[model samples]
Target: MMVPCALHALWRTLLPVSCFINSVLAAYDEPQGRVATAMTLDPTPGKDAGPALPEAFVSYAFEFSSFPDFAGNSTSGPNLFSDQLLNNIGNITGTKPYIRAGGNTQDYAVYDPSLPVALVGVIDPERQPNYPTNVTVGPSFFESYATWPGARYVHGFNLARSNGTYGDEDLLGPVEPACRALGIDDRLLYWEVGNEVDVYNRGRFAVRPPGWDEADYVAEWLNATRRVRARMGEACPELATDERFKLWAPSYGGTDNGLDAVRPWQDGIDADGNVVEVSMHFYMSGYGLPGITLQGTLLNHTNTAARLAPHLNVSRALAAAAPGVPYALTEVNSLYNAGQPDVSNVFGAALWTLDFNLWCAANGVARVHMQQGLNFRYASWQPRDTGLAPKGTRPPYYGDVAVASAVGDLTRAEVRVRSLRMESETDAASVPSGRGEPLP
Candidate 1:
């Protein structure tokens, strides 16, 4: 069955990034039906009225890792807390979003205050361009968050050791300062353990012996959470008791990532009331895959929706199981591995991102941290002074703007997908306004 999407009337503010105006112009050949019309209303109303959209629907966040800083590839770069970035986010969403400090690098990171800067000795720089195996950075690295306006930080700590023992040093250097930063601003979102634990047994980044299961992960996670909590209680007593101060656990990756989410929650991983939300990662496709192309990965709604069905299904069940606890895609984007060059950084990504977020909102995802890194092709904005891409907003950013604007004014909104066609590419001078109307 072909599922119809009715996203009419909700995209009034879906603005394309100016840099991507060319792609937008190219999508339409000439004037067809209603030109340049904002989706105003649903032509076919549902049998029963839907509920109002939740505030979380419009919420957007960014994810960065400790590894990037050591390699000088920090997503924030010298503009650690960019007013331009924050203002742009705020303008679109009507709310300031949090920045998640976690990723593959988070698990590889260690809190060694002794080091002046981070040490990146694990991965050979020549071989691993995007991936860093080992890195270390000092606590002050988090001070950048202070510059970010109304910033809430979701920090991640290293949980597993090199020997596969579920332990790492109780490095409170980064956490303490972040807590202090939070004490001043009162905006620490949650402390997450490790990056993606499901892949630990595969013997990759943070190698572990074969047969690492949920029981092992839960035991180690609880220990790490308590250790951090104790330090937090001493360093920032206010945050220790603050209800908002919480833990997000079992961040897992892989196709079976959903199953990994289930085990920890079912086993009462966060029964101590410290865990506030269940978190996981999602990427529509990975870089260097055999058949991935822009049209297949970003344009086709059927493929995108099908790929996400498994994750969404698990998320729905997890929501039902936990009742009030929300499930979040702590790390998500169109393509993983720093994304594909033109494909992920184009106007099609803007469309894909808009559709992707609405799908998550409809399926009960509370928040999405679109992961970005230095000079990544799929980054919403270039964070560093890179020669590869211009250091400004990219096409995917427009999608963020559109999603935020889509949910900005409404106390309630519903998103549904419907079939719509775009005209072909033509010269810029004679291009049409590119309007869309509901199909009757």
Candidate 2:
């Protein structure tokens, strides 16, 4: 069956790798000895297909504590390399990529006004060396938001530290300052309350007591979000209205994890009717997993499809529950835990990224945010020099650039993407075969 997808015409010159562009249909043919197939394109939109997505459909999510390092504060000046890279994509797509300044660290963060720097973090090497396990952001932390001009953002709040008790103020403390900072330039897209709360009840990452299910999560979420809205109303009154006070919610780790991604919605997690998007996280494979290979894991189309099936199911359920609310892979990349070394950092990873993102657009997913951090093996680019890695553009950044160029100039026309069925597990394509009619 042909499904509705959204992507634009491809610019072959911008792609560093071999990607064949035939009219509006763009196909990433694998190297010789892989798979080859002929595919047809249907220009007619499917009955169930949604509208074309935004120009910046494939954006980014920076690790929370790394925001200052990636964007740089007013004092340090914006990271010129970061700006140049993002600008390259914007130049192709006609919209600067939206940034999600949140991740696991967002939940662990605490606002410390007395602190002089933008961020102060403590990384527990045993727990996770890539990101800080405990983090504090000072008043200057908000200054990083203004550094990346024309880039919109979804700022996350500290939901994990709140206990939902009558007097608990941890979750409410950052709302005022956050809203005030975002309100100044209208760069705020939506507020996210937490990150992967579903796993807070299990493993070494456990924070909530055992047996904490969907009900408890929903209640806490409602209480915290309501408080957040109330504080935002006081701090940035213009953004607190029904039209503006929206969130990207239920940012679960996966669909079949500690908590089902669909249950939170069924439990009225968005009881306030302010959840603008149903967001979730995904990792193709975990770092250090046995038998992982570039072609077998990251570059394999069949494996990618199998891994994404659950998220697609959850997206369908979310569509039924929240009608118009979009589904986004707010945090996603090839491998979790900062990625596997050789497999994730190679040129093959760029191919995987191009295939992965186009596949998402074809399957009705509204947006895909490639998650990254400093020195991360799978990161598109290292924002700063670290002990482990130097600051420079990586292979995956080229993949991001290719995807942006493929989905060109959304301001001019409404483009729809469709996947070309391949006979082999290695092949993938996003065909937009005909000239799209101009938007009214």
Candidate 3:
């Protein structure tokens, strides 16, 4: 049976970057489709029914890590809380809501690591499983989007020896409370340990702490999952439900994401358990946006997705090695240019987003999170100068989905695009190494 995919993961990897362009252009010779009818993309806000989504999907993401920092400013306004972010989310993806936290932020924080975690919403971290930060950020985000009809969540916990597990624990501190806050604790989809630990010190990534080993990760994860198991055992007494927890890892880039090179954390959960999901990330392009006409942008894109296939394949294979646990590309994106208005705002970026998501669903990806949709920020390629949101709309804005809604629905059709590519003789190095560090 061909099980349909929700979405495929997208991320920027050090693929055998194909610079050839003229040869890879996709043949849009099918006599324009309904979407291509407008001169430019008519992404302008058009009524409430926006467009039907391809599938009942979850808009995976890492959009809310920062809060508006306007302290004591009596601007005498609504003080843009979580609602502002959720407002746009509901207005956009009008179906099953899916979201993840921890985009380009550290898992551990300034709080004391030695003491028991003091979570705001969920009572005990052990009982709850994966809870992040406090209610201020988590609740704010949840409250904003939770009412989105049928929303679900994937929480990435903190892991690092300095605080919980230098690269262990799958660091599930703040996950529980966040789920409780969302009121979907029972359906608390999946959780990840940290962001791309494979490409350490590369892009927007921090260094692995002292004594960070693969075994250490498995051990810490064992301890944390035990708590979750204990909680599950305790649940039957109160009307029985398996709302415990699942394991996820490496949170970034499909290739290494740290699990493959490092020892697999197959400590607990037998081989047949559908409970845990070994998570990773995926992205494309070095933060800078790629340009491809309907008849262009093939070699680079295809090679980019293919290059990371090994990594994704490794991730999928982990399910076999550490059976029972499913595989997932938790964090993904076409580029790291989150807030960069130029690259992220172009129709090109929008196109990339659609293609990447479709790719994830078609490939073996279990789930995908598009960094942070709420708090869009410029990534490595954006230098220090770039706007947050685009002044006007072109692509990568809200309307990027009209196509996603279309393509995401056509899950059965094997996407076959013939592109015209002008190949660049150089390799991945041909693209300038941007500022952001590659993920660990």
Candidate 4:
């Protein structure tokens, strides 16, 4: 029988390597700024219990900097994994979450098979010097996956190889070592072909021409995935016939203007059997846009749900087009472009995360991979101390902890969201009574 690829992929990301104690979870109440009039959940009598929520529902989103900063580099001081932290994560989630090593930096990464050093300088320090990018990584970079016991890995490869900077051959070099470090087909998840390749034309990487569309992406993706599959077989015998050893591709960003779910359906990536997931990225709002504010962008649930509805609608169509294929938000957070400092890093961000993730499950999204990074303004856990700030949990991590507890054990039962209702009342002048007039 074929493994439930979508659910499996989503499950891997559901557990992340951060801890929010029970006390913290209790402390985080749904923010008072917005309150539902009344909500109810009534399980349907004959509905399939649906997929169970994994032990956790949030996973890590590491930037390319993680290679030297969090993964390898024992010589560079302390790594993100400590016995106490790992234990805390496990205790909170009840299972180890998968780690996704990719972000904007993943697109700029090149593989160096025989480099003498563990890492080469990637990002320009003077120009936002600390940001992770513009570098090549060696095999030692993958060795760090071993540090987290039972923790699976979803490794991203450079897909912007169109300029002859690298080829499918160069891209496949990391697979063998990654497989070895991950116990040779044991803990490795799917290889993401690209990071939001849909927006490549205007994106930071600008890897493709402005005229590029899903057709261009599909053709290149097919070729790359085929090569990666063949290499996986040669590197690990177990993967030769295992369907679970899959590729996730055509990761689209949160805009409906470009290719929609039908693109992957037409490309056959969704139902190919070996392809595990059709993933995308989502954010509540664009950073630095006019009128963008903390209350309006990340804190407002009504605004967020409306913004997310289009993507969810696309996912629903994709599920029908390729029956049994899982749809996932492989990368998601409150805001795009790293996020706004005080807003994305605060308690309200946690509330946003919890509400949004639950909404995904209720709406049939197989998995929601909550994205994070070291010192990123929107990160849930800060891996290293910079200046006066010491490394520790950020406010949004409590959302993850709350999700982990809410999900509990997926193996035993499922968290089935039955229904949602909204009833509005009005008085004289049509303003809500609580605020002195009836609500509109």
Query: Candidates 2 and 4: which is better by lDDT?
Result: 2
lDDT (Cα, tens digit) per residue for candidate 4, span 1-440: 00011122232322211112211332234245654343232333124333555444556666765545555444454365533454465575566666778777677677788876656755576544446567677777776676565667788877776335565555787778766666554677777877777777874546677887777777777777667767878886576465656777667776574666567668666444677776778888755668776555654445555677887677777777766767778888887767777778887677667666765665667677777665677777776677735678788777777665555555544444322222332111111111222112
Evaluation by lDDT, superior candidate among 3 and 4: 4
RMSD of each candidate?
Answer: 6.2, 6.1, 12.0, 7.3
After superposing candidate 3 on the true structure, give the runs of residues whose Cα lies further than 4 Å from its correct spot. Answer: 1-58, 67-94, 109-147, 161-176, 184-187, 197-211, 228-244, 250-254, 257-262, 265-274, 288-299, 322-326, 337-341, 373-394, 397-403, 407-440
Which candidate tops TM-score?
Answer: 2
For each candidate in turn, the TM-score is: 0.79, 0.88, 0.56, 0.80
Name the regions of candidate 2 deviating beyond 4 angstroms: 1-51, 164-167, 423-426, 429-440
Which ranges in model 4 have alpha carbons more than 4 Å from their true place? Answer: 1-56, 72-93, 125-130, 162-165, 203-205, 270-272, 387-389, 422-440
lDDT of 1 by residue, 149-211 (tens): 575677777765533453345344466766776677666777787778888777454356677
lDDT of each structure? 0.61, 0.77, 0.39, 0.61
- The per-residue C-alpha lDDT of model 3 at residue 422 equals 26
Badly placed stretches (over 4 Å) of model 1 are 1-81, 117-127, 162-173, 254-259, 387-390, 410-440
> What is residue 214's positional error in candidate 2, in angstroms?
0.9
Give the per-residue Cα lDDT of candidate 4 at 19.
16
Comparison by TM-score, 3 against 4, better one: 4
Give the lowest summed-lDDT range of ten residues in model 3: 14-23
Lowest summed lDDT across 10 adjacent residues in model 1 is found at 422-431
lDDT of 3: 0.39
Residue-level lDDT tens digits of model 2 in 43-67: 5545433457666887999999988
